[model samples]
Target chain A: MKVTWSRRHVLETDDWSREEIEHVLDTANGMLEVLSRPIRRAPPLRGRTVILFFAEASTRTRVSFELAAKALSADVVNITATGSSVEKGESLLDTARTLEALGGDVLVIRHGSSGAPYFVAQRVGAAVINAGDGAHAHPTQGLLDAYTLRAKLGDLAGKRIVVVGDVLHSRVARSDINALVPLGARVTLSGPPTLLPAAWRCGDLPSGVGYEPDVDRALDGADGVIALRLQRERQEAGLLPSIREYARTWGLTEPRVATMRPGAPVMHPGPMNEGVEIDAAVAHGARSLIEEQVTNGVAVRMALLYLLIAGGEPRLIVGAEPPTSIAGGEPPATPLPTGVV
Target chain B: MTTFDRRALEAAGYLVVPGFIDLHVHLREPGFEDSETIASGARAALRGGFTTVCAMPNTEPAIDSPGLIAELVARAKAANAARVLPVATITRGRKGKELADLVELAAAGAVAFSDDGSPVDDARLFRSALEYARAADRPVLEHPQDLALSARGVMHEGRVSADLGLPGIPAAAEEAAIARDLALAKLSGARLHLQHVSTARSVELVRRAKADGLAVTCEVTPHHLALTDAWVAGDRTVAWEGRPSPRATPFDASTKVNPPLRTEGDVRALWDALADGTIDAIATDHAPHASVKKDVEYDLAAFGISGLETALPLLLGGVDAGWAALDTVIAALTTGPARVLGIDVPDDDWTVVDRAATWIVTAAGLASKGKNTPLLGRELRGRVVMSVVGGDVRYEGDLRAAPLAVR
Candidate 1:
């Protein structure tokens, strides 16, 4: 069931085949070993150029992907069109194409549009990596998640992963779900209704994507918890409600961590308002995989870059796994009917 | 038969009705036993007073071929309890792929056709299924889900799911599939039977489709017609029994079935559909998963519970709960399902002494295998004292088991 990683859509995890998921996971693991070597690491993207264009403001993602590219010896260029052409009114597609025309070898992008990466991937000849996109997906986040889970659980096939926080708003959790699913893990996404995405999209979530809303409920037998940092900017932009109430209801505390299945790791796509999205104590706890996730980001991205350069011929060498099928994973979920987003 | 006195039956308010029928039941004969076996399941069906049950085709090996349909017919007749009408898979192996041998399956006693637990995603494939069903003069029952819309949702997507934090199975998921099926059915001139519709909007869709002159009929599961995702609120912990339910509460793993349970508004709509003639029949979707498979973590629990034993009492209990009329309720259990399955069981073929037979029963007394009954300890308004299918008294709880006179 291992499939080729066609740079089409990063909308959901199943967008890639189980083979692709495994390839990414194994490559990430290999990168982990490569990072741990006395040599530290070899530059995989020695001559490549990685362009980071984030429409939405970010500190962790921009840094992680940027650092990832830098660690791979790639030339990195960062762009935040927030105050640029976007303020003056420029479409996202045009912006992506503009980046493509500028000799961008790899477009590591995060946008407000769900399928922005896929659009750019199709339009440009360069390899496209989704940094994060409009409440839709963050492919590298998912890759790092798979890396973190593999580090803790060793294998993902039978592991139970619970992703908690603003699912409707966090591009991190959405993409994490997309990655975890194809990696042969039982992934559940939970959050308040305001943050919950279309349930139907998760129903037939192509690769074992399970949906839960209650964080406590989703956390019961969970082997890992990926707490999404509810974007504070989302509240300012009115994508979410009050932050204090959100923290009170969704904040992962040490006590809550104690209640999780033993040794269950916790993760956050960082630059977290520590006590707001997750308790500072739990964020620093033994089970906290946030730091490890950052470390794996460079590795996961190295694998993605390696895969892009190697193309179809050497993908099989990365150890692709079998795909897990579910009655769910049905997609094209009933869209809100209005393309208003 | 353990004979019981008529006095005891009458005291329970049980009465005699014409044979009862269920349009949806998965016997799991050709394949899949981690879930159910035909014999044990059929025994439960007989105990539930179902003289007939239409078994679905989404089994392990799948029942898309005429040979599988023929095998099902032989097995059911051999059991000689409930008449098992086979619903062959509309597509090969129910992948929603290519069309199957509809004519062959129909000729070999497939009363209907369906992918059952899945919607035929391909429009051309679905249209072909309808065309084949129309040509064979059979209904293609479908578990409609607009894959895209129904994704991510682990339960009925709405206020309760949001409040409980369970991924909601949006009303549009059901609507999208049903709408597409209706359109295809209309275009292909096919008789389309929708299975396990769980939303009020679905009722509206079916109602509108029927009004538009589309030959569409729909069935509602008892779970959907009764419970909602709110059941998880009583113990939000149930949502995480590790499984996600897009339709009903992840209550008892054994109770998990798809086109999952809906909200109270959905329940009202189902009842309203029955009352207004929008819902065509009452089907059990009598899925029986082993205790181990269903008792696992909610996410791991098999997505089905056995309902053959409770269909009648549950319908009658709906009356007790002020959800249906006496005649309408029995009609749903008996004539409604029979008609939906394309069977014509007449009153003259059997005997109906009383329609208001009371069934005061405990879950322990019901012969269903899986202990996933959401209706345990509830009283029902009517009971089938005798189920005489085709002139054979297949069931007689407290009444006489007489030979059915129907030819």
Candidate 2:
């Protein structure tokens, strides 16, 4: 199907509609086939430049975006705060302009400030993707998580998904709710009151989301479970008493997993504390989709890079046979070499 | 004045009122000239209809000594725009450690004593400062905020901050500090003035203190009365009323200010307080920050708005909206602030405002060097046509010109 994608930035999923989200997921499915192949490459974004500007440290997200850009044959340059001009206090706008001037078609930014990506997006002409911006949003992760869930359990409509732990600080959880609620999913957030603020239930969160302090009640008959990483800083900040206490009370153990539907997938946006937020068994268990979430992250990012940079056009090799199930399972009728793509 | 000019002024329904007195303004001179100088801030004040302004002493090295106060007086005299009343720091260097020579500073022309950017966190030191300020015969202006509660928060702690995932400054930060200051004021019997009272409970606290016969006064900012924290959510429409349309993106650092714009409920309470005389004055905090300071991330951006030029129009808009009685709003700007500072403002020093005029607030149009205001593109009602300070025409915009071009 020919998709006329007009959006230049994927800063947040808050304003994305159900159709827009499904379109991204559909595009991601095609990218997954490319990832599954031996060649594992596409020519859609060939000669294009993708700048991974991570002001905050992130191994998973940064690498995932790098792999996504490389898979689409785009030149990827990684810029981190520690070594770059950011260390000399170059403003986000200046850094973005510098990269854009060097022919960066897309700027994937991860910043410690909540609205840093939005700050850059407003100033630059490049397609901006929010890799994660301080407690504010991780839209691509939200999309990938949704992609993983939808791949496992078809049609998320009215599906019960419980997101447990650190919802207050989790841009992942906020974006998940932003992405899920529009796709007809009931998102219940469960954690300690310090991490999962009461305001989430009444504040401007999407309508289909709720807060459940009781982890068991929150997990009860849930279709899927997403466990968030519990940062040690939260304890130092007096938000949590102790790591041991957090594990004893709110940790996702085998018993808690059993409360949900049998075989319901457990997921975490990782660098996980195995014994704290989730047990080692559940993390490595048959029900865990954490690893798949990471893999799907690449595909979701590729879909975004393609849709935003390539403008939703499938630009495969000139004379090669169209890979089955690529580009939403329908090959372009005419394989035109559009230089713009 | 010529008969034609008077008739034109009359035809335009201009109201000549007492020159506005801003009790709280940051003339970021002495140190941060990149943001504002006494000359520019005074000119901006004159453009806004303020003939006299209390220049807050949160400058580099702060106006803590008699020498600095005299220097500020000299600079204001040279500026020749608005009367700049220098407020001396309560603590030497505003360190909140040792007290400044309040008597000497006051005698040098310090109208009030304050460390306006920060609260005097130590209760003992604050109480001592109040006692000393009483001897100096100047009100101790408190920038009410408990740094502990307001730790690292960029905006008001409410539904908006919660939704945005930004840290919030709870209303308790202001109230807790106010409670401590009120207790100290009662103990010292010194006149205490609260700066930029934003929360509803703060208004109530000052109201009860005034009823209990404590010498307490507070000033509210126009941004607080007219705008809410919703402005931070990137909806200009949210400054007035209603929920932001779905298209509202987050983060405009221009809306970032210390004692962040609060909820709509707080705005309503402030309006009610302003009308009921619970709120003593409407002082433009008039904090000016360099564009570089505000052109970055929301968390990193400096907390201020270049408010000197926008104050009159914003308060006038409030009057037009029937938020407060016209007389109440005018008094809050003029006589109320005069009473707060205990100054006999000259009757001849007045401002001619075209009440029917409307002008859009633009950065280039502002006389102040700081162009960081949330009201940047907004068309505000009422414009100051001319301002006379000490019977001298300090600022004279074309009175008969079209409103849009007058500024």
| Winning model by TM-score | 2
Score each candidate by Cα lDDT.
0.68, 0.86
- lDDT tens digits, residue span B1-407, model 2: 32224445555567778899999999998999999999999999999999999999999869999988888899999989999999999999999999999999989889999999999999999999999999989999999999999999999987778778898898999999999999999999999999999999999999999999999999999989888888898866534444454334579899999899998889889988899888889998999988888888999999988888888878876776677788999999999998888988776788888776778888899999989998887777788888888778889886656443322
Give the range where candidate 2 chain A is weakest over 10 consecutive residues by summed lDDT.
Answer: A323-332
Clashing pairs in 2: none
lDDT of 1 at A255: 70
Model 2, position B209, has a per-residue lDDT of 94
**Alpha carbon deviation, residue A41, candidate 2 (Å):** 1.0
Reported per model, the fraction of native interface contacts reproduced equals 0.04, 0.64
Candidate 1's docking class is: incorrect
Best by DockQ: 2
Model 1 residue A94 lDDT score: 65
